[model samples]
Target: MTAVRFKPTLLAALMAASLFQSAWAVEPFVLKDIRVEGLQRADAGTVFASLPFRVGDTYTDDKGSAGLRALFATGLFKDVRIQVDGNVVVVVVEERPVISRVEFVGTKEFDKDVLVKALKDIGIGEGQPFDRALADRAEQELKRQYLTRSLYGVEVITTITPTERNRVNVTFTVTEGEVTKIKSIRITGNQAFSESTLISQMDLTKGGWLTWYTKSDQYARAKLNADLETIKAYYLNRGYLEFKIESAQVVISPDKQDISIAISVSEGPRYVVTGVRLEGEYLGKEEEFRKLVTIEPGEAYRADAVAATTKAFTDRFAAFGYAFARVDFRPELDRAKGQAVAVLVAQPQRRVYVRRVNVAGNSRTRDEVIRREFRQFEAAWYDGQKIKLSRDRVDRLGYFKAVDIETVEVPGTADQVDLTITVEEKPTGNLMLGAGFSSAEKFTLTASVKQDNVFGTGNYLGIDLNTSKYNRTIVVSTVDPYFTDDGVSRSYDLYYRTSRPLNTQGGDYKIVTPGGAVRFGVPFTEFDTVFFGAGVEQTSIKGDTGLPVSYRLYRDTFGETSLSVPLTVGWSRDARDSLIAPTRGRYQRLNLELGVAGDTRYLRGDYQFQQFIPLSNRFTLGLNTEVGYGKGLSGKPYPVFKNFYGGGLGTVRGFEQNSLGPLDIEGSYVGGNRRVNVNAELYVPFPGAGNDRTLRLFGYMDAGNVWGEKDSMSFSDVRASVGVGISWVSPVGPLKLSYGKPFRYQDQDKIQRLQFQIGTAF
Candidate 1:
C-alpha cells in the first residue's frame, strides 16, 4: 500500500476531526447496554463501578465522549476505545501497570520507610499504577529533603523493574554526596564586641569534637535567623537600639563538610530616653497610675522597662472595669541626635460588666473543677485582682496545657463583656510502670501509680514500688490539696517502706520505717508561702551483725515509736513559662524543719536557687544550687533519718548512690551530716525538628560534696561530673537519658552512669 503524505498541521487537524466524527457516530448505539473488556487485574464490575453514569441512562454523542475521557483520566488505563455494534456500546481499555513493591538503594541520609511515606505524600507508590509524572515528583521531594540539610550535590535516580501479574517493582537509587558543616563564623564591623564573643552568642556551632552527634555544625537557614536575633539582642541590651544585621553569606568548602559564615553588621549610635509623655484619657486618675510606671526619663532606653510600663497601664485600666483597654507606645525618633521620645497612648473603653464566664477546651477535667477556681462571677463588675487569681488558680491545677482568659464584647451593649476562659487539658494521671538495665543497677523494674486529682476531687494518691538489690522501696501516700477553700493547701501522707543498699558491707543493712505527716501551706503574699507540718515515725534497724556499735546504740535509743512534731515553713516564687527548658526566670525555695516534740530532736534547713538565663533566643543556661544543714538539738543525738545523703545521678553521677554520706559503724558510708550541690545545664533544641519543644539536647556540669559539718568541708572530698544528655517529650511521656564521666574523684575508677526519672513539672 502506498502511504499518503500531507502537511503536519493538516494531518493533526484531520486526526482530531476524525476523532470527533467517530464520537458522533457512536451516538445511536449509546442508547443500548454497555459492555466492558480487559479484566486481567480489575474486574469488569470494577471498571463499570467507576463510571459516573449508569447503564440504560441517556447517552448522547457528548455522553459517550465524556465516558471515555473519564476512564482514561483515572490513570488506571493505558488505552480506551468505544465502538458501536448495532444498538450496543462496546468499551475496551488496557489497564496500566500496577506497583507491586518499593525499594531503595544507596541512601543513608533517609530511611526506606521515610522515603516511602514521602513518596506517598506526593501522590505516588504502592497499588496505584505508575506514571512518569508521579515518578518525577517523588524524585524532587527526595532531593528537597537532602538539600535542606546542605546536601547541594545530591542526585536521585528511579528504576522501574517489571514483575509478574502486570506489576512493577520501583527502586530509588540516591547519591547523597556530602554533608556540609560550619568551619568558622566571622563577624565584621563589630567594634564594640570581639568576633568570638558575638559568635558564641549564636546557637549554631562550628565543627568541633561534639559535631558528629550534635550536627550543630550543619548549615541551616534557621540557624542564620537565630544568629541574627542573637546579634540584635546583644546590641540592644547594650543600648544599641538601632543596630541591624546587614547581610550574611554561607560558603561551602571543597569537601562539602566544611562551611564558612560571614556576617555584616551595622551598629548605629546608642540612644537614651529623653522624655516620656502620656497622651490619652486619664479618667481623673493619671497621677495615681503614672507613679506605677517604673521607667525613668533619664535612664537608658530599655525594652523591658517599656513593656513593664505598658503592662502597668493596661492593668490599671482593667482594675477600673475597663476590660477592653489598650495601651501602646509610639516612639518618636530623632536620628540626627540619636535620641527618642516615647508617647504612651492609653484608651480605656466603657466599663463592662461580665455577663457570663464560660470555660472551654477542658476535655478531661470537669467544668466544675475549673469553675471552683474562678474568683470572678457572672453579671458583676470586672476585678483585675480576681481575674488574675483565677488564672493563677487554673495554672496551679497542673492539669492544663494552657489557660487563657478572653473578654468578648456584647454586640449591642457597649458596657457589657462576656469572659471566655479557655483551658487546654494535659495528662493528669502520673502512674508509670517502667523497667530498665544498667551496668550499676543491673536489671531493675519500677512501678508507680499516682493521681494528682483523685476521682474528680482535688485529692492526691500514690503508691511506689521498686525491686532491685541496689534500690528497693515500697510506699503509699495520700493528700488533699484543698482541705479548705480559704487558699490554704493542706496535705497528708502515710508511708511504710523498707530499703537495703546493694553496696553495703559484708551484708546489707535494712531499715523498716512507718510514718505519717500533715502539712498546711499558708500564703503570706502572692509570691511567698509558709508551710507548717507535724509527723510521727517509727524506724527499726535489722542485720545488726554488720552494724557498728555506734549504729546499734543509736537504733536502741530511737526504737519502736518516735513521737515528733515537726514545724515547717517554706516560701517559693515562680516566674517562668515552663518548669522544664525555661529560657528566663528565677526560682527560690527555702525550707526549715524543727523536731521540737519527738523522741529525737533536731533542726534542719535547706535553701535552693534556680535561675534560667537566656543567652539568646536559641540558647538557655540553667543554673541550680542547693545548700542544706542539720544539727542535734537539746543535747540529743542527731536523727539518722533526718541526715543528708549525696551521690547518685540526682546528685553526683560519677559516685555511688548515698556513697558520699558518713561512714557507719560497720565501716560503710551511711549518710552525710551536711550537703551542698550545684549543677549547670545548657539546653538547645534537637536538630531537624525546627523549634519543636518536644525534644532537646543538653550539656551539664555538676559539682557537690557531703561532709560531717561545715568545718569538715574540703575541696579534696568534693565530687564533680560532666555529662551530655538528651530529653524528649514522647507520646508515652517525657524521657531523659544521660552519659556522664567523673572529673574530680577520690580514687581512680571507671565512669558510673545512671538514669533517673524527672516527671513533668508545672
Candidate 2:
C-alpha cells in the first residue's frame, strides 16, 4: 500500500513541474483579444497599432516583449507593460507629460521667439513631450550660443512646472554677463616677421574705438582657426615652403571680461623655384600652356602663383568642353639647397554635356526671369566661361542677395551633367526716408521708393522726393528690362525741380524745371549699351532780386518761361566687378543732348570715366573725371537753366554746393556752359575692421571749375581740395561723410568743409 501511494504522488509532482517549465519557455497561444489602457491624449488606435500582436493572432513571450518595446520607442509614454491573462493580451502605458508653454526670463541677449525656435529644433518646445534629458540639452545649447557671442559668463537655469491634464510649462532663467573682449594676441617662435605685422594680417584684434561695430575683439574658435590659416598662407606666399602653425592657446580672465590668445608657428627655410614644367596633355598647345604658367624659374616659390597656374590650366581645359578636368601642381622640394621644382599635371577625364539647368530658391521671381540671364543652353557642351558669365549677369541684376551655382553628375551617365543655380532672394523693393545735416545744406529731408524686380517681372519702378533748403525735386521713373525680349530696355521718367540761391534764406529768387522723357536702351555688346531718348522741358525764372545775370538775361530775351524739345543720345560701358563697391574695373559714359526745335536751341555733351585699381587686398585706388561742353545754335544763346553746376558732394567736396561758377551782379552763382572735374581717391579698410570693404576710410583729392559761355576754361583757375572721408554701407543705405580743406582757392570762393549724405552710391 505505501509503495502505490508514493508512485501516484511522484507522478503528480512531475506533471506540475512540467507545466511551470512550459510557462517560462514562452509556449505559443492564440490571442482572444487585445486591449490598451492609460491613454489620455493619444488615441486608442495609436497604441493598438504599435503592438506586435493582434486579436486572433498567435501570442508568445517574444511578441509581448516586442510590443512593450515598440510602445516605449514611440516616446509618447513614460512606462509600458504587456500582460497576458488566459490568452488575452493587455497593454498598459503611462503617458508622458506634454509641454504646455515655454518661457524665458532675464534674457536680453536674444529675442524670446529666437530662443524658442532654437529649442524647438532640438525637440524641446511647446506641444512636445517633456523630458529631463531634453531640458538639459536645451540649456547647454543656449549656453553655447552665448559663448559664440563672447558671453562666457552666461548661466542658464530651467524650471518645469506641472499643469492639469498631464501637461507642464517650462521656463528658462538666464544671466548674460558682460561680453568678453580680446585683450591682446601674441605670436611666438616668429623670427622672420614682426609681431605687429603678423597681427595686422589677422581679422581678430585687440579692442579699439571701432570694436563695437567690427566685433573683431570677440573671441571665436572658428575665427582663431581662420586667422591661423591666414598666417600660414602669408608665410607660404612669401617663400616659406614649410611654414606651419605649431600650437595655439586662448586664456580667459577670472572675471571672464578679457581674453588673451597666443599662437606658435614654425617658419621654414625660404625656397626659390629652380624650374617649372608641364607633364600632361595640353591638347597640342604646349606653348599656350607654358604662357599660362605664373610661376617662373629663379623667383621665390609662391603658393598663390602655383594656384593661379593650375586654375588657368583648368579654365583653359574647360573652355574646350572638358568639364571634368583636373590640374595639380607637384612641388619637388630640395631642403638642403632651399630650392624647389614644380611639375603641373593635367587630366581631362571626359567631355560632358549639360543635360538640364535647374533654378531654385526664387519664390518671388519667375523662372523665366532667371532663365533668360543664362548663356548656357540645355543639351549643349559644358562651357565654364559661359556658365560663369551667366552667374555674373544674374548677380549684376542686383535682384538677389546671393547667387550660387553647382554642377552635378547625372546618375548612370558618363558624359552628362546637370547645372543647378540657387539664389537667395532679398527685398527687391526699398523705401527710404532720411534726414541729414551738412554745413551747406543744413538740414535735408529725403524720401525714395524703388523696386528693381517689380512683381517679379524684371522691371523697375521708382519715385524720389527731396526737400532741402536750396533745392527741391521730385522724380518718377519706370523701366522694362525685356521690352522686346532681345535684351532691349525701355524707360520713362518725369521730373519737377526748383532751385534757390544757397546764400539767401528766402526762396523768392528761384528756377523751376518740369520735364518728361522716354528712353530706349539697346544692348550693343556684352558690356556696352546705347540709349536714345526724347523729352519736352520748360524752364521759368521767378523773382528778380538776387537772380544770376545769365538767368536775368535769358528771362529778358526769351520771356519769363522758355519751352524746349530735347533729344538725347548716350552710350555706356561697365565692367565693374561690383555695383556697390568695385575693387577693379572701368566705367565709361558719354551723353549728348540737342535742342532742335525750341525757344532755346543748344547742343550739350558730357563724357565721364571711372577707373578702379586694387592696390592690394586691403587698398584700392579710384580715379574719376568728367567733362561737359555746351553751345547755342541758330543764333540763340545757351539757356542758363541748361548750364552745369559744380562744387558739391558729388563733384568738389570742399566747396559750397553749386557755388563754383560765374557770379551775377548780385553775387549769386549763375552756373556755366562748360565744366570739368577730376577726382582721385585711395581707399583703405577702416581701423579695427580688418579687410571688410563695407566700411572704409578714403583719402581723396578733387579739382573742378565751371565756365560761362563767354569765359575760357583754365586749369590754374580751378579750385582744388584734399580731404578724408568715410564710406559705410549701412542697412538703411550707403552713407558718406567727409572733412575737407581747400588747398587752392580764391578768397571769393564759397567754402564749406564738412559734408555728409545718405543713399548715395560710392
Top lDDT hit? 2
Report every candidate's CA lDDT.
0.75, 0.87
| Models, CA RMSD each | 8.3, 7.5
Which portions of model 1 miss their true places by more than 4 Å? Answer: 1-58, 61-101, 110-117, 125-130, 162-168, 189-194, 253-255, 280-296, 299-329, 346-472, 477-510, 516-536, 545-550, 554-584, 588-640, 643-762
TM-score of each: 0.68, 0.92
Give per-residue CA lDDT, model 1, range 84-120, as digits (tens): 6676667777777898887888988777888888888
lDDT of 1: 0.75
Tell me the deviation in Å of residue 161 in model 1: 3.9
